[model samples]
Target: MSDASINASTVTTQTRVNEASFGDYFSLLKPRVMSLVVFTALVGLLAAPVPVHPFVGFCAILFIAIGGGASGALNMWWDADIDKVMKRTKGRPIPSGKVEAGEAMALGLALSGLSVIMLGLATNWFAGAFLGFTIFFYVVVYTMWLKRSTPQNIVIGGAAGAFPPVIGWVAATGSMTLEPWLMFALTFMWTPPHFWALALFMRSDYDDAGVPMLTVTHGRRATRWHILVYTALLALLAVGTAFSGIGGPIYLTVAVVMNALFLRGAWQIARRTEDDSEADNYKVERSFFKLSLLYLFLHFGAILAEALLKPYGLGGWS
Candidate 1:
């Protein structure tokens, strides 16, 4: 690019440590984000109609989690420049110079192969193949391509995150089915409003990093409206899943309650201006962001409960 840009990137990569700590290496894994991946993947595995041996299930999740972390490291490696510019990510392993980008890349590549192969051996080729594709989609497609180029980056790239539950299901059943896709849809649809809320409050982060978030490309008002629309769509899909094969009284009850609150939050966000947001310090947006974290967990937890209860004729519509 330009000399100025090169200089800025150099400044961003300035070192913080002469030697990386064990924790610095672990930080490359993006453990917090990986936790969500593992949780949802576990829920998917457990919620499948078929059964997995406890040890097999444990191995499957462990591998999937590793695959998730691999994707995280690769993402950090690629985004190190932007990470340094973005306050939310400046402290990450690569950006803060706790670990070299090459080190992160090597770790990511090694883990990618290891996780995929181990997952395949422990579960099935389908699950292994799915994990490999997810890493490729996140690192190659989203991180390298869509993230910097378009506002719709999250809309499409979200499929990578959504795949975990499907992989979990496949690990158990060794094949695909409609039920796991419903879980996929739940996370897919939830991603937008969930992230947009964060964008609402963290607009400056994307702006500073030049990431082309919805808030940056479309403006805050449009982003707010987008959140409302997506939340509405997510609510419909969420509530509708309650009537599907995976849905039962418990899931339905949880869906209705959480979705109602989610929609209300979206509505409150939509009915505001930049002034309104600034005046309240984006309190509603921050609340929505916090709620979004729990939204997926509780839904998956409900699904897990439903699956666990199925043996007693208590789960799903029987």
Candidate 2:
């Protein structure tokens, strides 16, 4: 082959190798996290006292999901460095080289603006503003600032994840109320314990990445204690939410059962020695982490069921 032709072929091959697939861009959104956001936000929207138009509700959720995706993109962009080192995050789009940091940033910014504007046009300015603030909190406050700085990172950063329900409620009602805040409280309180459980099992990832997770900063013993303490508080808040307007027999039942299992899990975790953890392959910690996922989902699912039954005066207790 001629030298020029050989050079052109090499350039084409390199370009093809560097090209990102559609799934690569989607992976930057952290779809797993976005699913939780969508579910909680939907429950909040449904649980509100005022009814919303179906089409408008759909638009609000769509925009909110987009805003969530934007946050994920921005988080990936900012955390690309640490992500590359963490075993858990090394495969993320940016860290794995499937997506560029610059591209993620631009996508984040663009979606951030688009979601906020569309939410406001579809619902209300308040909801739009809340969505915008959520994006900023997750991307700027949590990922950029708190994540690298403190053991309390997840504790404070949890608030950003907790805001979606409140924003959803606002999207439906155009105002704030105690009920939506209760939903926010549920998520906020659940965050520390949920994450601490994972940290117990995955401390190496944070340690290697140099992130100050409680497990790394305070040791596994302290992290276990933190999980127990937070789980107790989360139980209080979860059961209390059962008495709120969004709660009912169904929710109360779910709360009692779930909290019992959750407390048991936390207590078991607290009782475990590091030796025990090693012996059992961190089974207790891993189980608690898995349970935590269901704990939040069932709680919100009960809330949604209550809302669906409210029209028949069968929702909350009389």
* lDDT leader: 2
Q: What is candidate 2's lDDT per residue for 1-318, written digit by digit as tens?
A: 899999999989986877789999998888999999999999989999889999999999889999999999999999999999988999888877778899999999999999999999999999999999999999899999999999999999999999999999999999998999999999999999999888888858998989999988888899899999999999998999899899999999999999999999999999999999999899989999999999999999999999999899898886
> Residue by residue across 164-282, what tens digits does model 1's lDDT show?
99999999999888889999999999998988899889869999899999999999999999999999999999999998878899999999999999999999999998899899899
Query: Candidate 1 local accuracy as lDDT?
Result: 0.92
Provide the lowest-lDDT 10-residue window in model 1: 10-19
Q: What clash count goes with each model?
A: 0, 0
State each model's C-alpha RMSD to the native.
6.1, 1.0
**Model 2 poorest 10 in a row by lDDT:** 91-100
How close to the true structure is residue 71 of candidate 1, measured as C-alpha lDDT? 96
lDDT of the structure predicted as candidate 2: 0.93
